[model samples]
Target: MNANPKILLYILMISALGINTPLSIVGIISQIAEYFNTSIAISGLYVSSFTFTIAICGLFIPVLFSKYNRKRTFVSILTVFAISNIAIIFTKSIYIASFFRILSAIFYPAFISIALTVCEEIAPKGEEQDYITKILLGISIGSIVGLPITTGLGTIFNYQVAMSWIFAINLLSLILIIIFFPKIKGKAKSYEMPFSSLKSKEFLLATIGIMMMPIGASIVYNYQPYFLQVVSHVYTYKLSIFLFIYGLFSIFGTWLGGKLIAKRDKATILIFQLICGGVFVLLYLFANYLIPVLILILIFGILDGMGYNLIQYIESSVIPDSPELANGVFLSILNGGIALGIAIGGFLVDGFGIMSIFIFGALFLLLAFIILYYIIGIMKMPLKYS
Candidate 1:
């Protein structure tokens, strides 16, 4: 198998972009508010607006990029991403910071969708799965890295410093792309618009199944702090430690996912989802003890990393030709799932209490697992959804 090293550059570029922005913005929300002399809710526009833009823009990226040079467009996105990070770090006004954040966010889905398509182009023949797995690992690892970097730069020093660090990460990605990536000639082809593919049962089911698993993840992620507080009662430093441990192990987990995908396909998906779903149930059962809670989280992180890659592989399998459309739609749905998970989990917390979130989170993954099983087993669909 020919290993194309440029794909590594692609992975790095995407991973760095994935890691830097959100963590810095989220980690520093309170600090940004304090610095700008604004309320936390107002400062939080940086995250909320950015997330909103990624999802909305994501839906249209494949179609919009059809008339342009993907590489240049992606690079331009990174340049803006870097500049925005730098701008936010120096800006004193919340409104000014919000402007740059929204600017950067608009390009995030473009970067992600383009990166996935490029990874497919550069893979060595039959080594597509390997390439895809590595790219997914790159993404999962970004989330892992975001925590400690944010904890150190945001919590310890200040939000400005955290933003500066993100500035460096984005700048590095920009530089790497210019140096390592080959000339991106133009759009690959006029992809059948991603929205049009929603008519296929296989495509729709894959989208729903893939999206549902992430909702479980988002529920856990969005509510971890609240749930942990309820569990350990005002714990701070230990929570940080647990997150770091979760992240470190997850980097390894992505590699494990790559290995598993090589050996097994359908079984791997079923088992990974079940274990991830089960972890949430275990988390609830052991919430009273700090050690058990941390252990379950660590397991959750590992499986989460593996599960993301596995599901992406499934989605990619469904639409082998139109990778741009497939990735764009999948990402849009993933964003929707995250939003749904967060919103539903919030309501559950307000009404039924924080512990109820675990039940719902577990069900989300198991439901995903069942969907995967039905599609692959009962329906035996070939995913020949053109």
Candidate 2:
């Protein structure tokens, strides 16, 4: 059974839907706060709780159901995600809405873990990254297409309507998965969870290597709207357009990262960190200028975009045979970064200023880059050459 492109598209789209459900609120966080009659600090908890739930699930879901049917699990989880989005519309309070978010989060690892492993499984050996790129492209769509559109809807109608937009996307993904996905029933044999995965010093360093940039990225991400408002004075619909541009360029970055991964995996990642770190610094400098700020956002978005592929590629390479463990840790730490950033950003925004988030993000990235370079230099980890 050769890997079919059409089937791969189905897998990628479905995986994107699973992941993007939580992201539906990206640009609309502030709006959600107003709608829920809460403070921005409290509203920030949505992203934190959502990511933290995924972090917790990422550590365990892979081990618990290593043998389960990947296709069925994918479909089942999307079904739950779809149901949750629909149910969220009926919830009368933030508490109920948050419950649905947490509930949907549990299924995130199921799709992501399955998607990565399946991409590897269905690829024509050694071309797995090519398939992985297709999925990452789908993720980029969330920023470019899904998020902007959903946020736009929120700007126009309300958050409920924005959620309905997500519901629509999830529905499309669910239908496509069942129709086009290959039926690989039954479990994968030879599942292995090496305790050495935790004990490996090099692996831990590499994991932390990519982790810092994401922490910084999330600091900006979770509070971008607030920053844009303070910096460029763009609001609502106009803001979503800039975000769309930010997401659109990220696709190019994804393509670039995919190509570079073929050559200098770790080096390419480190270079991106340095570039993104600088971009974060520029965000602070150019905050007062509209055109320059938007351009910087584009550069930041592209680097951030490349980062998704780089992180997953490195994590999977660390434990090639164990897809769940690899992807599980990938999702865990990545979301852990987002959770931590949002948590800390709440304090920064409330105490310091909106601009402080970017400064903090920049510092985090620079520090991470320094540490990553030292680790790679000392450990002499072979990630493809210069």
Candidate 3:
């Protein structure tokens, strides 16, 4: 069945907003800590727990649900997601809030995987990447626009209000999905096993390389609110503005990644990692200066957006025969990396200081650069230019 392109885009964008609702809480984590009478590190678990649940669930959700009706499954998942967000609105403790976050995250990977599959199915020949890029724009916009706005709400009113905002958006998405999303049939029972794609050495190496990028980036990003408060002396009101600007540039970066990856995938990603590492190091060196910090935020935001799409492009390229499985593994590893980054960042915050996380971020990117180089350079894997 042919789906209306505009309606499909709306569905994808709204679903992404719902998926990213938990992340919008990052800016108010300090308030959460104070509310629960806990440490900042513990308060950070609200983000980490959600990401970690997605990581584990992503590994198997696609494979388990591959034969289910895509439209029905997606609608059902969003319903549960809405319920989880509403539960968070009433929770009085950080730990309870985190538990509901985890419950909501259980369906996230499957939702993303199905969305990617639907995009691929409808994309005309030779235009798959463009379609993929459009869907990823939904993700970028959710981060760039949704995140800062919800963060501002939480800052102005309270966390419950922020969560209510998320619930409202998600509810709208559910209504749209029920009305406009096309009914796409699932794969046949005899479809190839998802794990079949993991047997390739190139795919495995590419996954590892992509995983490192998030771990590196999240080390700094997960604690950005606290970092800005302590190191840059950015007030809570101003923090949302800075995040909004960072997100604006990030949208550009996402678009740029789609454009550049088509020409020179390996070279583009390699240079991005190298420059990203340098930018992190620079962030550490100039942490105390507002001018340099603003510049770096713009640069890092772009790099951050580029990383999201480039990594997905590479992952799918390595295992072209299994897009659903590849996308699932990509989400799993990506969020797994984020969880790891948060853990590592928490350690640094407790021991060295928040500024130290940037240095460690640079180190992780260096490692990603090395593995990526090894795959394209030493292993001589043929680059597929779409």
Candidate 4:
């Protein structure tokens, strides 16, 4: 099968939108707090709201769009996303901005889902992993460019300007999607039911690990800047650089993960990265030296990037029957776990300290490792890769 350049281009555009998310979010939290004269606790709710809605929608999008045309589905969602981005520019009220965010969240899962679907449809037999990785590379690139640009812009200009950049990215995505994405008209193959494959012990354990990685990563990503600036008194520009490096390394990490998983098995790569990631979480929290903190962030970023890809690759490798639907479940649980992590991390920061969030996140990943090891090690489950 030939790789479609148009589809890849569309993925790049949508991935930019994905990248804009965290950058705009972290920047806005501080401004939004000051704008309303509210506490940081209140501003943090925006992150929770975004991820929570994403989790809910990820569970249902595949089923909802099962019979619908893929092109139409994506265009409709992108239209809503465009409107939401434009609305954010004018809406000063927290409730209004948040309402738009919820709207955007409803459609955001398609960004990944559609890309994966396209890749799978076009990939050669036994090359599914490579295709998925390349599609995900769009996400990696988006984060790399989006974080530094939006964060820095937010610091220099107002949050509205930062928001405008996101809107611009979305507008560009809409245009490319409209111009390039082929109208893929087809009916989906109906599955028996979701979570039907959960009976398999290997799937159950792998899913648990898949769920842990995103939630654990988001715990730090969602709130680390606030911790550094508000709690540790780091300067805004300096923090932006740190965040940029984190995201930049994230892309590299994900690319490396694709290569590693292709050469080895997903389980071995996942286990090593998760353990190392957990250890770095602790090191990041205690390191007072800025250099050490930056180093830890780099390490953590690589682990996270690889881990995210690992989850998707593992799910497809394990279940090969319905890759997109399997990914849907993976995304749903992973996102839900992310919301939970943020909610818990936020509460801990409010009650205990910023550092405590890392402790909590590390524990989450560690627990996931224990579950993963038992299935792969004790039960002697087949590795996803054949």
lDDT of each candidate versus the true structure: 0.72, 0.77, 0.80, 0.68
**What are the per-residue Cα lDDT tens digits for candidate 2 across 215-268?**
888898779878888667999768767767777788888877888887777678
State the TM-score for model 4.
Answer: 0.83
List candidate 1 stretches off by more than 4 Å.
Answer: 1-20, 194-196, 383-386
Q: Who is ahead in lDDT, 1 or 4?
A: 1
C-alpha RMSD for every candidate: 3.1, 3.0, 2.8, 3.5
Error of 4 at 5 (Å): 4.3
Tens digit per residue, CA lDDT, model 3, 1-386: 77776568657867876677666676688767766778988987666677778888887777677788888988898898888887778878777777778887888887887787788777777666666777777777876677777777887887778778889988988888899888888888524664655777887888888888999999988787788888778886588678778888988898888788877777897899899999999988888898898899789999998887777877777777666766778788878887889889989999998888889999999999999899887987766563
Which lDDT value does model 4 have at 284? 53
TM-score, each model?
0.89, 0.87, 0.89, 0.83
Q: Model 3 segments beyond 4 Å from truth? A: 30-43, 90-100, 190-196, 223-232, 284-289, 383-386
For model 2, where is the 10-residue window of minimal lDDT?
377-386
lDDT of 1: 0.72
**Candidate 1 C-alpha lDDT tens digits along 1-386:** 24355655454546544533464356667877888898888877656777667667777766566546755876788888878877788888878888988887776766676676766667667666666666666666565676567657777888778777777777777877777665655555566565455677887887788788878888887898787787667467877777677777887787788777767776777888788888889888888998788778888878876866666677767766666656666666666777778888888889999988889898888888888888888878553211
Q: Sort the predicted structures by lDDT, highest score first.
A: 3, 2, 1, 4
Best prediction by lDDT: 3
Cand. 2 TM to true fold: 0.87
